[model samples]
Target: MLKAQETVLEIDLKALKHNFDHLKSRISSNTKFMAVVKAFAYGSDACEIANYLQKLPVDYFAVAFVHEGIQLREAGITKPILVLHPQAVNFNILIENCLEPSIYNVKILNEFIATASAEKLNDYPIHIKFNTGLNRLGFSENDVDTIISTVNESTSVKIESVFSHLAASEDLNEKDFTLNQIKKFKNITENMTKQMGYKPLLHMCNTSGILNYPEAHFDMVRSGIGLYGFGNSEKENKNFKPIGTLKTIISQIHAIEKGESVGYNRAYKTDTFLRTATLPIGHADGIGRQYGKGKGYVIINNQKAYILGNVCMDMIMVDVTNIDCKEGDEVIVFGPETTAENLAKTANTISYELITAISQRVKRLFIGN
Candidate 1:
């Protein structure tokens, strides 16, 4: 085990593998799995996580943009990487690095085809993204015919897969909408494949979709949060183990008398004498200001330490009076006892936001490889 630092995110590779194997067991043996490693693997060392998953031999990898895929490539990730959102400006780089681009619209499709043709590339792999119900970054269902025609015109690029996003697969209340999305994606892919001579791979399920909509797990499935140990539901969360633990140390302790304030703007004032501990972490470290003033807390000595006042840029004061701890003592901002899901709930957010917000400046210590 690695020693705890002043502030570090302890990443457990064993937990990651467990989650991977668990999710993998849920899918069919023939179904391909693509691990989403975008946003630095949800802000937990993308290179390290991708390297580990590569050994698990996931069928593919995905990232939100071209630069992220490029970073993975630079780190020696040889697995086929699908850039979820690729711009025309980076077409050359994407081509040079052999990174597949998810062509979402007419402009991107046309531009990438033109660039690929100019580069004399042949049969280059490209994924097509349909909007379905997400209304995000994808071609609308009505554009399916146009998309097929455009792909047919491009001799340099070949469609590797057709996929879409689920807007609310995690919400049980949105089951109808999620099912409708799956149906729409199915119709789009079927129509495209019928028109084209060959059938490309079909995939639409994300992490939540994989858990809730097994019937829609087409030719492949993509997992992001699930790989990092979250299932978007209480029951499913219990089955997976969170792999990242945000930990820090108490920098100092202060004894404040009655009516004294703590931290900036006097957001927290003491009614009586109380002890507070200053931690070397704050909004700049990804614990946003909204989490301060009792909204968020930390775990010390197996007790909760509420934020005393407004979180500062690089420091935060926590009410540690009741807890027995000293300077340099270990503090779990969020880990096994206080999960990221719970911390995000306290801040009125989700685990995705909290985990992804962890800053690059904070060190990441890998354990249990």
Candidate 2:
């Protein structure tokens, strides 16, 4: 393990490759893979992660905004990048950088078409996102005619792919709903292709979707959380390794006598003599206040030290009375043993929330080349 002066998020590139290979093995041989590197690759350094995957030679990359794609382009990532949520103001930048936009609504589609025409671009690749069941984004299935008409009117831009987000591909109870979504996507794509005279690549699966519904792999599949080493299920999680480990060190230890209080607002009061260790991380570092007051914990010397008081913006106190630890000892906030999934569950959240919530201030160390 690398030494840490304070808090650090260690990213294992070897584990990342293992996850990519494992997820790739689950999909069809011809199906292409797109790595979702949005939100700084889920807060683990998007440039570095994407750069690493670029060598792995992923078929495509997806980001949530135009600035993210620009960052990757600046970093020399030449793969086709899909901007999932793009704004008109950044449409010109997207065009200059050759980043494709996922046109979910007519307004965006029209705006992008106008921009592409102004730029004198020919056959500019753009993706069409359908609403399917995730009513968050995408055109409604009922708007198929409008979509076809809009594309037919556009000569500068061409639909390169048609995709949708699965609402609940991970939940076994929602199997029927997932199947229905797949069916809807197929029908919408078929109708669009017939009208356009050429079929764009069709994809509708995310990480969980790929693992649970392989039959709907279509032309390509996207892997986000799964690429970061989570399966969204216990069975599949065993086959992958977590790529990130958040660790910190003990800054100081305090001996608290009975009736003594700890941390902001005196959230924890000692009933007996105790030893408390202060860690140099708290809500500001993405260890939110909700995990304070004895609800969350850290692993020290293979022992779980429960949080004893409220978490501050820069510090947290843990009950380390039983553990024989000293200042500078390594403390694991979440890692292989203390999985991010388990930690998020203790806070009544999910692994995605915890992993992505890691603050950018924390230094990230890449290991396992």
Candidate 3:
């Protein structure tokens, strides 16, 4: 361990376990949990996170790409992994690793089926994603017949689960839309299962859906953000603990007078006698340049320090004026006190984007209870 001495993402596995246990408390004994570990486990460390969760015995794991699953497998993660959006080109690699693929369209389904048949594979698990409301990457409801036909003809493949994505399950304003998606998903699953003469596991709820719409918990729930310690709302029980803390140290401090500029392009001019500190983080490390120029901030000595100017690729200057701070002092980029959700609000984006946007170059230190 680096002993919290540098720009690091401190991951609280205790909080993660607590979050998982809390979310699991909402469902019954039958509803399995699938932890989503895509995007480097939300910019923390997928292999480490996966390894930890495997010890927790989560029912399954999910990744966004085939290579991500492969990465986990190489890291000694033996749990069943579902590849959310696998490319057809990597079908062989996916099969070689015993990784399941999510088939969203008939073309990919046919291609996978052919690959399985050619390899003489038996019992290859595959999930079908339907576009209930999130039309980003899923089969249309109208394609139920085509989906059923494809499943019926595929002898080498075994249907594992049928799932969908929720676009706005976190917002109560979109309740009607989420309900509509739930109804459509249920209807499609029922019709398809009846037509195909086999009932695969059905799942549709993301973290928000699992929290806001418990009725749609289905057979399994795919949780990403909730597992990372963010609930749909702080009002939603307020029990979900944040699992990641981004901490950095002040590299340098400067005392400036009025009219003195700071950072790239001299975007910010000190209004009064002030003290500023440069953080060892910026857009290149996923702080994002849009958050610069006084728009974003960091917390030092329990005080908020506004960004002094444009966020550089490797550094950001903060107006630590009037605060008791010094070089090598710990600075909070985002954590329990300065949450990623709050930071996202500052950047006019969502927490999902904020967490996922964190670059891989940042060191991540994992901790347990």
Candidate 4:
């Protein structure tokens, strides 16, 4: 519990383990866990998180691209890394790294087989993504027969897992839709398993899905936000602890008279005398412009200080007239108690976007192995 002298994101591995064990408790003992460490582990440092989880010994690890998986491999991660959206060009390198690819459509599957063949690889691990309702990636249910035929024809690749994503597992209003998605995934898996003559591992639950729909746990479950300490609902949120704490220090303070403006474009002009604290963090640090102009706030001396104006590339001014904080006083942008989810709500965004949007330049410090 040391104070931050400069802007830093403190990553608590203890909280991460707590979140992991919490999510792990919800699934059956036989179920597997897939740790999603894409987008730099939701902007908290991917290699560190993946390395930690690799020791937690998650059954599988998933990333958004081939490069992410390669990074994990380079980090001494021996567990199977699934590349969720790999390109044809990277397939060769991906195979060389022993990174599995998620084959979403015909072109990707065929091309991956071709690449595997070129590398003289037989039965290369691959995952199949089905478009249940996300519509962002994955193949159609109708494409299953074609997928079966394609895989049947190729000894170059093997289906490691069959999975899909839940579109709105967090919103109870979309419960019916979410259930329909589960039904479709089960149906698809049934057909795929029957046709393939052997079952690949099956998974569909994200963090929210893990909590809300245990019946869809399939063979394994993926936890990304959950591992970062967010359960996506008010009730379930209490069960997890946010691992990354964003903190900065006040660089300086300003006394502004009425009609004086702060920051770019005069976005915030005080109508009365006030004090402002300029912080060394802004859009470039992942505190976006949308969070400026009173839309977001920071915690100072346990008091809420609203952002004063337009966020600059490397700085933000916050109104701190009533707070007893001064220059170099530690400021909390978001953490376990304040919670990124709450701060994100103020800016009309989700925790995923807020956390993942954090810039890479900010230093990261880890606590507890």
| TM-scores for the candidates | 0.98, 0.99, 0.96, 0.98
**Model 1, 12-56: lDDT tens per residue?**
999999999999988999999999999999989899999999999
Scanning candidate 3 in windows of ten residues, the lowest lDDT window is 1-10
Candidate 2: stretches off by over 4 Å: none
**By TM-score, how accurate is candidate 4?**
0.98
Q: Report, for every candidate in turn, its global Cα lDDT versus the true structure.
A: 0.92, 0.92, 0.88, 0.93
Residue 200, model 1, lDDT: 96
Model 2: lDDT to the true structure: 0.92
Per-residue lDDT of 354 in model 3: 83
Cα lDDT of model 2 by residue, 1-369, tens digit: 686777999999999999999999998889999999999899899999999999987999999999999999999999999999999999998999999999999898888889998988888999999998889999998888998888788789889999999999999899999999999998998899999899899988999999999889999999899999999999989988889999999999999999999988888888999999999998999999889888889999999999978899999999999999999999999987779998888889999988888999999999987
Q: Give the winner by TM-score: 2 or 3.
A: 2
Mind giving the per-residue lDDT tens digits that candidate 4 earns over 1-369? 669999999999999999999999999999999999999999999999988988877998989998888888888889988888899988878878988888899998888888888888888888999999999999999999999999999898889899999999989899999999999999999999999999899999999999999999989999999999999888999999999999999999999999999988898888999999999998999999999899899999999999988999999999999999889999999998999998999999999999998999999999987
Instruction: Report model 2's TM-score to 2 decimal places.
Output: 0.99
lDDT of 1 at 52: 94
lDDT assessment of candidate 1: 0.92
Q: Candidate 3 or 4, higher lDDT?
A: 4
Question: Candidate 1 regions off by >4 Å?
Answer: 1-3
Residue 346 of model 1 has an lDDT of 92
